[model samples]
Target: MKKVINKPEQVVEEMLQGVVAAHPQYVKRIEGFNVLVRANGPTAKVALVSGGGSGHEPSHGGFVGRGMLDGAVAGAVFTSPTPDQVYEAVKAVDGDKGVLLIIKNYTGDVMNFEMAAEMAEADGIKVDKVVINDDVAVENSTWTTGRRGIAGTVLLHKIAGAKAETGADLTEVKRIAEKVIANVRSMGMALSPCIVPAAGKPSFTLAEDEMEIGMGIHGEPGTHRENIRSADEIASHLLEKIFADMPLQQGDEVAVLVNGLGATPLMELYVVNRKVAAVLNAKGIKTAKTFVGNYMTSLEMAGFSITLLKLDAELKALLLAPADTPAFVQF
Candidate 1:
């Protein structure tokens, strides 16, 4: 366990403090709680909150800003935040309008966020939620009940947050989020596993020349493993599976996200995106917008995921809306 840290138990707290120190203009820490809220929060609109384990950097936390999340609760590494912590986030961000919890499709995340929503409702805070299940990896994984939410959740955060920022009510926000979830699909492949500081070991193991297809973010075992191949071949395999599942056709415009799973370099990501774009172009799917970066990650795991969102006019506009977050900025 060669990690630079004071103590494993205090890693999340210290890391968040460092994030606040690094980006004070964008984020602030809630006093005495493992919650990070936008510096200018309680924005008098429908507040958006989402979170999970601490390892997925720039996710629930880096997203707390003007056009994305209002608050994000952090748990221990690769562990869900407690219900009470989530309840605090809801209370801290709720205003005259309401709050919307953007929960991913994981068992622990769903359960804890749901419990917090119930607690918030008890206090007369109008709350709605959208569970993102965009990963088309597998039906039943050990980590989640249904399909796991992966990089596609970033698009959900963007589109839904844009709607909420426009003063959409809880019902409308939830509707828009569901619409995004319905149209988006994602698939990921892992080149290497990540080592959780607390665990002091890699989550999983892979051979030097092997890759895990359809892997989840938590380093869960993927559907299968195979000898590593060229970037083009991997992109083709991923797109084939995603397109087969979603069935996009000619002349359909879509937003594409080629996300690095923490450790993959930008150069490699661009190479992968080249192949993804070629495949989509050949299939007549017009690439309306493309984002290639580490929007969502699994610690320092070496891998990437591709997300495709079939876009309508409404989705296009919302997706293009201005967003000012730590990791993503669109204007």
Candidate 2:
């Protein structure tokens, strides 16, 4: 219950205000709605909008900028935003080129974003969507049918956004997003549970020496739990699962993202990345680029996930394209 906030009900509103205040040049709030659109919105380029809950900061919102998302709708912590909010975002960001929605593979996210797209189409705004289900964890968990979207979604944003920035239409943008989804795979482990502000308690409990494997970002119980092991051992276990599922082979090039959930420090993330790179190198997979940091998060969860995207020439170029956003930037 040790949260630094004014009130539980006002948390999302206050946070959105803070984000707008902090990044006025890159984003602006749509008045009377919990939506953040790029400062220079309604551009002719295919607009990209993605969102879900609020706790995964610098995600759907932090990415609203050039070469990334054009708009983001915010829901309460770990809750899906309403279709009305999403519809407004589509309307606000759509220009002559239409809009694309990058929705994660959660049921609520899928349903809500679909409703919004339908509404937008009713209003004559062309819209398309791509669902990210890149987590190679488990299928048919209590929460979802297929895999859950995790750190791989960030790669989706970058690659799809780059395509859109280059004047790709909605169809092309969505196709590229799906291409990223098909090539990316992710797996995560949690050492400690996250405390949701409103709940005032950890979402789940894990013993001091235990870790949960194949966990989702919302603190849902993972596929299995085991005694905590060394960083290298943990990295091997995660990579083994991912590579088995994806079957990465020799002479393949990939992009690596070792993402800290929230509370884990960069030091530990790099430690995990070291082991991950060693594993990939031993497997004869060449990593063209590596990103080790908290790109995607689950509030204050103490854990991390690793995402690997098998890259082609176009994907590699898009992955290296410049992007400027509040949470991530590359030149």
Which window of ten consecutive residues has the lowest lDDT sum in model 2?
A: 138-147
lDDT of residue 36 for candidate 2: 98
lDDT of 1 by residue, 12-32 (tens): 999999999998999998898
Candidate 1 residue-wise lDDT at 17: 91
- Expressed as tens digits, the lDDT of each residue in 1-331 for candidate 2 is 7777899889899999999999999999999999999998878999999999888887879998988899999998988899999999999999879999998888899999999999999999999999999888875355437778888999999999999999988888888898999899999999999888889898789998899999999888888999999999999998988888889889999999999999999999999999998998899999989999887899889999999999999999999999988877889
Taking every candidate in turn, the Cα RMSD to the unseen true structure, in Å, is 1.6, 1.4
Q: Give, for candidate 1, the lowest lDDT window spanning 10 residues.
A: 137-146
| Candidate no. 2 TM-score | 0.97
Task: Give me the runs in candidate 2 sitting further than 4 Å from their true place.
Answer: 140-144
Each model's lDDT comes to: 0.91, 0.91
- Note the clash tally of each candidate: 0, 0
TM-score of each: 0.97, 0.97
